[model samples]
Target: MSRARSVRSPRPLLGAATVVAAVATAGSLFLSLGLGLTPCRLCWYQRILMYPLVVVVGVAAIEERSGVARTVLPLSVFGLALAAYHSWLQVTQTTCSVGVVSCATVQYRLFGLLTIPNLSLLAFLLVTGIVAVASWRTRR
Candidate 1:
């Protein structure tokens, strides 16, 4: 009789999530600083939720700490929700008048469809899913 064991490392999964967050953070900064795109209220909220994730998630991945799930999940989930709402506002042409620029204003779009909020939504979803899987693997 032979016994078989499956070995899985959560570090890779967390690392992927860290990369996602880092890219998203950099992209957002580039859009604002490089391109001079003004961030709306919702965009600012999403940024607030996402920016810290780079440090938090990156540290967790580097330290190989699965406990990061507790922090990452909440922030990512909130960011996802904000991004979704922002996307909806843009799609519906509803302007959220909170800052200098309207939230519904689409400064630019990729492929004439993908907006900034869309990218934010995707990034949050990826980080959320990856961190969740890493946490699950750690538990199992």
Candidate 2:
């Protein structure tokens, strides 16, 4: 007698979100390193949060572990908050002080509208939403 494999993996949504988070993290790195753009204080804070998320969620999703949500939840929420604040600072034009790196600097703009912070904020929001929904669905 042979043991059978399961029909499908159960955590597709989580897996996808984790992959997207990884992609987002890579994109941020590309913007900073490849494009020669420097990150400000808030950007550094956000990067600190986002970088780990890629690894934590990626491993959890690959293992189909239930504890993934518990680990990711607080990170996602805090990341979202940081992204939002960064975006707000960018929008308000009150980013840099006398000796600080300008958080409001729009290093690059796509279509003259989207900036670095904007992109970061958007990515965080999407990831957070996906994680929240996926966690809620899985718990049911």
Q: What is the C-alpha RMSD of each candidate to the true structure, in Å?
A: 2.9, 3.5
Could you tell me which 10 consecutive residues in candidate 2 have the lowest summed lDDT?
1-10
State each model's CA lDDT, in order: 0.90, 0.75
> Which regions of candidate 1 are displaced past 4 Å?
1-6
Query: Could you tell me every candidate's TM-score relative to the true structure?
Result: 0.92, 0.84
lDDT of 1 by residue, 1-140 (tens): 22222245677888899899999999999999999998888899999999999999889988888889999999999999989988999989867777888989998797888899999999999999999998887788
Model 2 off-target regions past 4 Å?
A: 1-10, 98-100
Mind giving the per-residue lDDT tens digits that candidate 2 earns over 16-130?
Answer: 7777788878888898789988888888887887888888877777786645777877877787888887778778886576235798776788689988777777777876777
Give the Å shift of residue 54 in candidate 1.
0.6
Which candidate tops lDDT? 1
In model 1, state the lDDT of residue 96: 70
- lDDT for model 2: 0.75
